[model samples]
Target: MRHPRLCAFLAWLYGNEATTGRILQQNQIIFPAIFWPAPENAPLDPDAVLGTFQSAPATSLPEVFELPGQTYLRNLQKISPGLWNGRTYCMKAFDLTEGRPTLTCSSGHFFDALVSCDLLEFELLSAFGEVMPEEEAFPEFCERLTLRGTLHALGNPLHHACGRSAAIGISTLIIFPAEGVYHVLLRSCGSRLAYLDKFFHTVPSLMMQPMLADERMEYSVRHNVYREYLEEVFGAVEGEMPYTPAQYHDIYADPAIQYLQNREAAGSARLLLSGVAMDLLKLRPEICTLLLIDDPDWWLTHRQRLRPVTMVDSRCGSAANLLERSPATPLYAIKLSPELELPTGLLCPERFTPPGAAALCLGLNQVRKLLLYI
Candidate 1:
């Protein structure tokens, strides 16, 4: 007997019949409250968790307010001025300048603060950032800022963004009175297409499906199938999208319907990768060595602050062309098989084990070299 989940997934994939936005809406999305266990063999104090906030930036003494069931910190409280120390949560009357009631955080050392205590949570910290509609071009009312080119050019050259990094310009919050508890969602001003790849790169690490109950296999299978189906239909390099896939995903995943559910009850699931790559990780939070590319024939010639590395071709969609066209620097590629390895010894050599594949892969190198000549 075949697992019904696998059968359904195959059917959905073949037909390309997807889990619609309507179905995602039907499921409840919630992020479980994650907690870092106090180090083992040591006495952990709950009071200590509160004390950690001693240096928390507080304009005045803590003023506790009982609004709904949730507690809020009133006043301009600097829970942690530094991003690395811990997250500082505060509550303020809604302000037009602050943008919408959204979730905001940072990546890098700044995001490290969130782990220390969940007490430091944002509550009504103003809501005034941009609200991008799926069909609309970015609103003219605000300025568009993106790390698209510049981010990949950095010393670390992050491959993907997730976690606090997603909070760079947008906000994350639980949309009230809409659905289940702790419905975490993002509200960015413009198309966040560049950041999704970075965010989901961490998905394999999250062990997302196993965390769920056995009975929910039907829902789970359909969901993963939907994402993969979208990739096949929309991710292809050459095609005329009858409907823009990016736009569809955005609108379908809107807060009106979608929410992020936490896997663990106590909140220790480290699956939040919404903001890691494209400056969004500060909102949420890479692996791989940095490789530099040197293609002078590329666009935008600047001083050699960072030299670029060359890629030998083996057609698994090298990032070389993409990186060369962008502001991202220190570009690199990992060979999937011998067919994909560049001529560089610095990269993994095991890829060349299959001799025949290696020969076919060399053809890709020839094509790239020809492009340089032309």
Candidate 2:
């Protein structure tokens, strides 16, 4: 197998596997175009890029989120006959008076019960249920959810080298029954932080510090550039660094931020449309879309309570462009991007992954996937 770091880097630089493959192929390396494994007892066609979009059936379904007249969850659950498709469920809600959190299951219990049962039964699987007011269940599942799940739902990803199972963390689908809205909520577990730390460090060392580093690097570069301009104009008589408005170039021009600003400035719109043909050729056979989260800190913080999730550099607005390159291309992105239109039935957290919650929060299945990546 190719070096995971190199594979990760190529994914970052090219913004998608199709482009990554093209970049490698253009260099004349006969690399495996497919990363995810195809199912066994199948064709030995190495030319095929395995993925769900191609392998899975496409129902031209009208995208009706919650069925009409399904105002209450009980009704929806009854008629839907396995709304979650049998995935486990848990509930979380806030205690306004106490103000921390109040999580429970439909059984009227808390964490202990959930842990004891090894399964959770909740109201509907929605963030509003986690954050809003609700009646308590008997022996509630728990106020704050902390545990793990099996990787079956995670869409197993096998790292080719070791033939090991990599954990994918957890991902939740947020279905807004009333508003007819649906989204995905992603989270990871505590055990995966060390792996994530290693992932972040693989990128430019400075990327590990978090989003604030981008700001600080900009400030430092701006100051340095201004100083250079001043010295050129006034003959190098340096004492304390002097400042002058005229000495400044656009912050975007600072060499330190050149790569970052250039990538963003290119605009996600252009990237999504630039390589339609290439994207089609490289589609995978299992997962429909793959978004690599570049920031370990962001992934750790924002993914709490959702599942074992990672946040790649959302600044890569190119994801939207990459997705657009192929009609059936899977969409991927970090925390934020203009191009990342998550497939129907995925939820994205609007806030940061809270500190110290990394381990307890990741998805059980995602953990299983990372074991493969590592």
TM per candidate = 0.18, 0.17
Model 1 CA deviation exceeding 4 Å by range: 1-300, 312-330, 333-374
Report the number of backbone clashes for model 1.
71
Tens-digit lDDT track of model 2 for 1-374? 12233233323323342312233221232222222222223222211221111111111211221232123344435544543321111111111112111112111111222122212112212322454323343113223222112211222211110111111111111111111221222222211112221110000001011112122232221233233322221223433212233223443354423432343355310000000011111111111111122222322333332222233343333322322333231112223222223332122111111111111112211322432332
- The candidate scoring highest on TM-score is 1
Give one digit per residue, the lDDT tens place, for model 1 in 1-374: 11222222222222221111011100122111111122223222211211111112322211221231122222212432332222222211111112111122111222222221111122101111223222233233112222222222322212222211221111111111111111111111111212222110111111011112221221222233223222321231222322254543543463311222221222322111111111111112110000012222111222122134222234424222333343332322223232322333321111111111111222233323322332
TM-score between model 2 and native: 0.17
**Among all windows of ten consecutive residues in candidate 1, which has the lowest summed lDDT?**
18-27
Model 2 has an lDDT value of 0.22
Backbone clashes for every candidate come to 71, 79
